[model samples]
Target: MSVELTPGLILILGALPVPLLWGRVRSIYLLALPVLAFALMLDTPNGVFGQLELFGLQLTTARVDGLSRFFGYAFVVAALLGAIYALHLKDTVQHVAGLVYAGSALGAVFAGDLLTLFLFWELISLASVFLIWASRTPQAYRAGMRYLVVQIGSGLLLLLGLLLHFHETGSLAFGHIGLESPGGVLIFFAFGIKCAFPLLHNWLQDAYPEGTVTGTVLLSAFTTKVAVYALARGYAGTELLVPIGAVMTAFPIFYAVIENDLRRVLAYSLNNQLGFMVVGIGIGTELAMNGAVAHAFADIVFKALLFMAMGAVLFRVGTVKGSELGGLYKSMPWTTGFCIVGAASISAFPLFSGFVTKSMVMSAAMEQDRFWVWIVLLFASAGVFHHAGIKIPYFAFFGHDSGKRCREAPLNMLIAMGLAAALCIGIGSLPEFFYALLPFQSEYHPYSPDHVTAQVQLLFWSALAFAILMRTGIYPPELLSTNLDFDWFYRRLGRSAAGAVGRFAARIWQAFAGAAAAQTSRIVEKLGSHYGSGGIPARMTQTSSMVFWTTVLLAAYLLLSYF
Candidate 1:
């Protein structure tokens, strides 16, 4: 097939130098790059752009199918918002890294083949790490290292799985996979790790809160969303994902409720949202897939909006812990209001983005006769409101009157948040615009009486329970302690276990080396006895030569008698 370069790729490549030369150009390049990329993405056709041969594999880098187009569109919007949110930062390193990170993610989603996806997957990892490191604190450095390790590790698994898959299937195309094959399972887990599936989810909570305020906004948009896209692409309809998604939905609320760090709470909330998409993927019908796609697009907007709000808090207050924050509405009313919209949207409140998109996933579950899954999802949706919707804004802005009189977020930050907030309401109010972007036709209506009434009942009751609990002093207050998560396995258990084994092996090696040395000394002494000048063998050889003549005659006589 003939290769044609899309405007998206061209704009992304052109953006590479903006950060490096940012100082010379006074950061105009930093601001312009994302806008240009967004425009380019909007211009690209919704079809495959180019195909090429690399390493004997057919690699297609820009395939703009329906599913990919949805994600790519979201990513470009995310890049634009994130750039605006991060406009206050003067650091060129972060500016460049963020642009590259966004571009690579768009590239990955649009990739037609596994090879191109894997390449961009690794590129996203490489470019995104700088955001964390830009914080320039010891904690940020440590967290960034861990984040890079996990991300790179995930990429390696993806690469391995892709290679094995290509070898077995004789195709490098990215598409649906079954658990029956090792390659498929490998790819699933690889995506799962990024998806923050159940126990593999701690890296996000650990790393995201540790990044710069601007970094957190960018961080929120890319990694897990990309993972969701991959799962939707390769593992949709895999039955195992149903329960995984269910657990993902239910478990994070407990942590988010009690967590001190606001960004970390959002991280857990992110996991919960991903669970909804995972379930939609497992259902695998056109409506369910559309729901997943629609939810993902909506999620990118609202979730980024939420992060942008919290990032603004962190940016101005110099901290984002719920414990350290309170009563910010007095000073930053606009920020607070924007945050409430985000919280409401995430809570699936009526006439918000979450209300429109998340209902599709739940409806899809019910349609598939997944009664129990639907119930669990219902509980999760309520829990989402309890934690993300109520808890984030309540603690950050209203719980206690924190005496902080800080200024509102920078103009760029406000513009970014306002843009995201607008999109959140826009998508929610006009569901058709989002529905049209879905990969499949949407036969399910979100505005039906049954859906609306059920959702209202669930959300209102959840809210009532939260209020009663809080009023009666039953709800847990946010504390300044780190909650144990999946990272504990690597951070505590894995590290301790590896250290113990290492020490044990070192001791055994030391003893073995000492014993070998002693034995070698004995062997050298025995050799010396036979070969040294003072030894019996040396003297015997010298003396034997003089007696050789006499001994030869006696030996000859004895031999003659014997004959």
Candidate 2:
């Protein structure tokens, strides 16, 4: 069959000009583009097309398959919601950046070869950093710089790994890779960094909170989800990711609990959510892969919704810090309700999106007899409910009623939140719609009585624990201080180390200059003493004594020769 241009591709490419030419238009086009893209993606065929050759390397620009379709659908939905959330902002830079970032992620998922994936990967990094920078604050600028550095670093590693893999395998196809090879390991770390694996997670927290309200919405959707897609494509079933993902799921809770910045807390929560997908990839079975893809789909929805709610607060209240916000429900009841829906979904409450999706991954873990893995995942689930599902809304809307009476979010923001909240409910009520899009056949049921009862018992008990802890003053309250993460190494210790080295070098240079000056002074003083006008050597050397001595030596030499 002849290659055909997909509607999704057309919409994505066509939307590029909306921000460029119409700077004054409201975000209507932004909201419409993703919906159009989704409409087009639903009709596209599942196969490779639009092939081209670059420098003798075969590149497939459009390759639609089950896995790619899953992620592509999520991207379109996320972009739509993000555009709705950001409608109040007039900065065309962020709007354009958000579109390009979304397009690139979609393009990356559908790419048929490693070279194509790498190209779109770098495009995402380059395009998305502008979102953070659009905040127009010094902290945002610095955070954007760090974000760019880490993203570019990931791109470089990915490029190097692709080249090495091409050399080893003589092909550039995107497929499963084993960690036994050096190239595979390089590729793994590239995905790991974007996946926010442990120490590499600093960029998410550093940059997300610093972004403009609209920018953070876009920031939360595409970057890490794309990384998750890449991992699902390249490193499925790699045993190492199991433990790495466990740590990713477990450790972010402590930080999120104590974090004062609501957006940063969400960023930590985002890291924790990625762990579920990572575990699915590690399980490497058909059902597990299905769970991963489904969770990723659900994650993009609810996470964007949460960010939307938080972004709306930032738009109205001028801050998203937990300590600075409270009692918003009175004035912004619509926003408060939407936020609760998002929180319910994230907490995996029954009849919510996360309930339908996250349970698949947990079920997959249990199926594999991963006892410890299941236990860790259970604790992480509770942690998710504790930090993101409860604490975020609790502090921002209901806690302390800080007497701040801000207006509700813009019309577009509420519409976006409403749309997302509806989807969260829709997906939960009918998971078949989501299950049908999975990479593998779906045999899992999320609503069994035993499963529902068990989850409720676990999560409700966790909530009770949280309530008791708070009532007795055992639970830590959000403070007005920054919680340190991996970025501390570079932001704090790294800069301090550089400063100390600079100061030490300065002191060494001063010492060397002083010694050189002393030596020069001694040489000059000795020369002046010996060669001054009144000095004996100065007076005699230029006089006849030198001429007499030369004449005597010459006469003696002549006499001796003659003898």
Candidate 3:
């Protein structure tokens, strides 16, 4: 295969002509970009391309390798699924945004240098927020703004970290940035923020639920997964991520159980899923990294399947709130079944996508003798069954009938959901295929007796617990209200502090302005007195001030040039 050009550019440049095409041409253009990009990614040989010296530092814009090829497949698959899902929409802006967002992610995955990574880092952040804005509601607008701030803030950290790294190491390479220096630490948190690390995760919950239905499904696929890739690429073997990932896997389940918004619940679920991958990356073994990459791939498919199902409900019934939804199985039975499949896959039921992938991470943890972390992961596994596996389907489909009836999801949405569901089952049932695609060879068999029995027992126990809790009326009821997460620290407290700073700055500015006005008045009076008809050369001085400053600037420039 010829490596003629950078593959990420296919989507990036292909998106430029989107809005110009009319009717079916635009649709074909949108759908073809992902396919072309995926083909290019598959065809490109393993080597660095687009190397250049910028300011005496080498930059590699395209680095095609095994790891990058894996993520490239993920990005293009996501975009293709998203494109098929969005085929009916006439919104070229949204299509353009999706393409640019996907392309930027691809670019980042293949980036061989820190500066190149940062370039696509900012672009992905900028391009993705439009998915939120496409919702076109005041809430979506505000949430999109907040999402952008957090995302761009991550990009800023990356830029500063890269600059400091260049200064410290005199290299721009983007690999193995261990957290032994200030720059590396900044870069870690930068990836951490995008990866939805515990304190930095509220953006996912706050904004994903607020995005357009299709937009949310697409949103589910990128960003955080990219962060996971970045972590695996640069921070592997960094021991701190082990505990961090453990905390991530465990905490979000509690929030998921309580979250009334189904999509927000999924958002929490996403954070939990990321924790498993992060743990694998931190372990930094071949099997563990394979687990992380494999889980990421399966996760994108099944998670997006779940989101697409809920998005169907959102599109048809105008709500995905647990309080407002029930007995959807009667109307949207296909969506109900798809949602169940996704729920099962995410819950790691035997023969589901997650079952094949998630176990590798936990096994890797056990291999590293991370006994407590493995215990936490075990507990998290059960908790996911309770919240995501059971609660999601039970509340949304089988709870008390909410008396809301609507048409099924549109045809395009169904096809998209079906395709994603098929992939989830295909990957789960045929683990050998995906295992071969992993960055390392693995002999981890998920269907071994101990593995299947343990998973089945875990599911049974978790289901029993949920049943008892519900029967005893101890379970929390879904209500029409928002739950606060870590974002409160900033959204409430930070906003107040910012308001205070703005007021203080305004007062200072007003004082300075008044004083300046007074000083100007006196100066004008003095000048008027001097520049009166009998005064000496004051009028000429006013006219000559501009010329004088220009000549002074010229003289300074000449002196610097001479020096």
> lDDT of each model, Cα atoms only?
0.84, 0.86, 0.90
* TM-scores for every candidate against the unseen true structure: 0.90, 0.89, 0.91
Error of 2 at 355 (Å): 0.9
lDDT-based ranking, best first? 3, 2, 1
Pick the lDDT winner: 3
- The candidate 3 region of ten consecutive residues with least summed lDDT is 533-542
Q: After superposition, how far is residue 519 of candidate 1 from its true place, in Å?
A: 4.3
Off by over 4 Å in 3: 1-3, 506-563
What value of lDDT does candidate 2 attain over all alpha carbons?
0.86
Per-residue lDDT over 272-364 for candidate 2, one digit per residue giving the tens place of the 0 to 100 score: 999999998888888888888888888888988899899889888888989888889998999999999999898899899999888888888
Q: Give the per-residue Cα lDDT of candidate 2 at 380.
A: 95
Root-mean-square deviation per candidate: 5.3, 6.1, 6.4
Q: In model 1, what lDDT does residue 337 have?
A: 89
Residue 302 of candidate 1: its Cα lDDT?
A: 91
